[model samples]
Target: QGMVGGMKIPLVQRYEAGFRAGVAATNPNATVLVNYTGSFTDFALGKQVGQDLLLKNTDVLFAAAGVDGLGAIQAVKEAREAGKAVSVIGVDSDPSHLAPEAVLSAVVKHVDLVVYEAIREQRQGRFQGGNVSLGLKEGGMGLAPVRLDFPGKDEALRTVEALKARIISGELKVPTQPAPSGTAGANP
Candidate 1:
């Protein structure tokens, strides 16, 4: 797996942490390679990074670099067109529409819903000024519907739902930070 991020911000780090955890849980033998482009708007750099990762034989690429991620998605699309067994995971929204052939799914963040709730609360004299933690159970973050046609997509979706339930029930904890070096899901 390859993960390309816009920057080393807390949000992106959290995404990486969750991604690494997911890979570890699903395929313990898999390795993750990560890169930070520093700038969130550099499409060229994102594409270059994506291409480099693909050259390393990454089966899946995760793009969380804002607009820059579009370039990574392009690289994955091209690679897939060239008959490479590769796909990309989008972020922020369901980008499967952009490249349904190459995009496996997305880690969607319902920012609009959050903003709407905040405004509604403010208008109702119930505004709060603090960070709020929301996850699958709160309808804040979730995986987009997988659009790729694969052999075990149904089974995979079922497994994902089961894991989601465990996470919501606090039976499975998705790490918000990468583990220490040499540990499972640790950053390289």
Candidate 2:
């Protein structure tokens, strides 16, 4: 419930905020602590922050920095070695296999799909590049299938899948916003 101010909000912050919102929507009583490393490439600092959070009894963490996140993942692994029950939520790509025991899930962004759809529209002479907004309905983002080695993996995976279905069926609405630039947030 506390904010960790940094020089700027990074993509990791967006991922963190999104996940935190999701977690809170599902579990209103959950407490979330955010830690920020001023730089995205500073793995050492990221690791230090992650370790500190672990020491504070934080069990689940989401590493959103590109390479910096790797450092956080390393810290989570070390904590696990010491018999700590810690887990990580990955970003961008499917990293469930990177540390199966520690990575619970990943917020997957289907860039390939977005690119492909744009290309298709261009080829069909329907290229309206003003803006494009994609979400669960548009199959833009989702949670990756949980790793087989993760505890309660089946249930975890099922929950995300069911949520996806609900989203697609209009039973659940995944919140989204227009890209900061006005030229990149249009829905077809």
Alpha-carbon RMSD to native, per candidate:
2.4, 6.6
The backbone clash count of each candidate, in order, is 0, 1
lDDT per residue (tens digit) for residues 1-188 in model 1: 98888888999989889888888877777888888898789888899999998998898999999877888999999999999999999998999888989999999999987998899999999999999977888889899888788888898889788889988988888898965432339322
Extract clashing residue pairs from model 1.
Answer: none
Q: Give the C-alpha miss distance for residue 78 in model 1, angstroms.
A: 0.4
Give residue 41's error in model 2 in angstroms. Answer: 1.3
lDDT of every model, 2 decimals: 0.87, 0.66
Candidate 2: how large is its RMSD? 6.6
| Among all candidates shown, the one with the greatest TM-score | 1
lDDT of 2: 0.66
